[model samples]
Target: MARALPQPRRASLRRLYDPQSGEELDQALVLWFPGPASATGEDLAELHLHGGRAVVAAIETALGNVKGLRPATAGEFTQRALMNGRIDLTQAEGLGELLSAETEAARRAAVHASEGGIRKKVEQWNDRLLNVSASVEAELDHSDEEDVAAVIGSGLSYRRDCIALAEELERALASPSVERLNEGIRIVLAGPPNSGKSSLINAMTGRDVAIVSAIAGTTRDRIEMAVTRRGYSYILTDTAGLATKTDDPIEAIGIERARQALDAADAILWLGDENPDIASDASIILIHARCDEPERDATPDDRTPVSSKTGAGLSVLWEKIEELASRHIPAESAVFFNERQRRLITEWKNRLEAAAQEEDLLLVGEQLRLARSLCDQITGRAGVEAMLGDIFARFCIGK
Candidate 1:
């Protein structure tokens, strides 16, 4: 510990010493932030010590020996900040994203969110909803009074405002989800046995992640490889060849999983001669594989002919894949919601829509109140005790 608390909010040169042993531990820079304005909204101290494992260990030992001193657990500081209203759930989520962000785009987006991008938008929605709720309350309380009735005007305006807010939030959902950005776009490569699906995936990713073989049903499961290209992220999935009649149980399971992958795919490269019977809304690109062979060089009207052996037409395939992915890639400044936030916001939007449609003032008021409570949950102001453990668990210690 320092001999004296460093000048408030300023870093000061200090000699750290072991409290019990009275031995100088290190010469370091220390900072002091007095209560109510610190990062955690509590009195805080910062130690800037030399980059040495022994130094940190000694300091830890010293602090451990002190009464009432203990190491902060994972996300403890950030949780304290949230509890004290220094930051909300969204910002805390953003900080977690920032810490784990692997790509430049993800980092930039996380930075924006961590700096209150989503919070500002939510605050605006809250204010507008509050105004609408107030108007509804005024009408319900004073419908008998002539002047108040005139000002309220049959409550059409507030209803319209509620509808408009709902529509706005609906549009906001069009932005790319945080999960998509974090997990990368799901791109599945699928086709009949020995249709060069494995070769193509290995070529696309420049890594031999799948076994290349002439034998049928070699791939008995999905092989996934994460790829980042042109500042966009993609998960290239090579699935077991879809055989019409397979007796092996493992191959059958693989084929079934391939179909499931198609269901979840953002885009599919169907490397088969015949058109695939895909039911999902995923973008399916018919692929003419082994185009380097003279007989298979003729590409159909919509099919992209690619030969992984010679790396022929791979760039074109990438262009098409990138084009499909670009539609879901959000702008850096755009607001993004994770799965939980999106669900809550969707519920809030639905509540607002219900308020807009309801004829009964009491029901409308109830809907508006529920909408407000959803906003509270989104911001971690209420009803998030069950979620705290899981959320903070994502964060590293002392964040």
Candidate 2:
């Protein structure tokens, strides 16, 4: 009627069996963790078993038969950890961010949060604002009505401090570093009809991601591929060749899509050395297609002439493109990798700005409180119940 408790931390050989049939399921290493040191600040056990379907299914079936033992729900263990105060909301959000990270830059940013990068900064801001609030509160509590000018002076000093913090937040949120890291750098291939835009993307990716053809409008749809070059992720898009007039409706739609892609691009590979007059701050690398073709200038001073057929200038092109991608990746900044974090940060910044401008000390303190609440939301504290269902639901069972 009793089970032996396995040694803590060290894995012990154990055999799992089906209770109904008394059949040995499989041998696995069972490790037991007890008490406050455990991840959830409670007793936890881990069963290290072979991966795959049949083995896992057998073990799961056996576990279900045991009295008073059941399977964990999605994110249950992590949720337990959260409830136990083992990790804060920022770290919990970071865990979610790390789970969904698709790129190296994104993974690194998420790691920063999980390692308390965000919490540290938020706590620092919290301290500063609390100190400011306390200063204002102290003046309000003071009995001396004679020194009215002194209170105004103290208020002015507090306003200056708030202004400084607001500007700092402004600069941090102004740069789209988080968005760039999360979305990856978009590099679009755009050019005139039969200008080898598709061919260039295929060559750049070193894969047949796009169809290359001599026909003017063969590529009637946009093809996109995410590629990692030099430890950086880039989204390479091959669009239908731009043409002033097209009789085919599909081709016209593709061309319009191409324009949209270019507009959204972080960097554009303008094939055939022609500017399409698109308004974008994105880097435009004029690429001259078919350098090996006859009746083409081999040396264009402004454009990078590349022959996809011969693999000319591709190496240099990648280096140039990576340089552009790196510009989007910032160093030493508090990055918000998801839309939720971005929105919360934006709200925090706006509230801080409003707090600085409020004439009444009580209103200014309230604004700071509201701003801190926004920061709290970003890190997963207040206003979390509304989002927990959606966020934790994404995690698989036993997480």
Query: CA lDDT of each candidate?
Result: 0.89, 0.79
Model 1, CA-based lDDT: 0.89
Model 2: residue 150 alpha-carbon error in angstroms:
6.4
Q: Residue-pair clashes per candidate, as listed?
A: 0, 1
TM-score for each candidate, following the candidate numbering: 0.91, 0.88
Worst 10 residues of 2 by lDDT: 330-339
Q: Per-residue alpha-carbon lDDT of model 1 for 98-208, expressed as tens digits? A: 988876668877888899998888999999999899989998999899999888885668779998999999998877777678788899998899999999999998989
TM-score of 2: 0.88
Model 1: which residue pairs collide? Answer: none
Compose the digit string of candidate 2's lDDT tens values, residues 2-26.
Answer: 2698879889988877888888888
Error of 2 at 160 (Å): 2.3
Maximum-TM-score candidate: 1
| Structural RMSD, model 1 | 2.4
Candidate 2 clash figure, as a count:
1
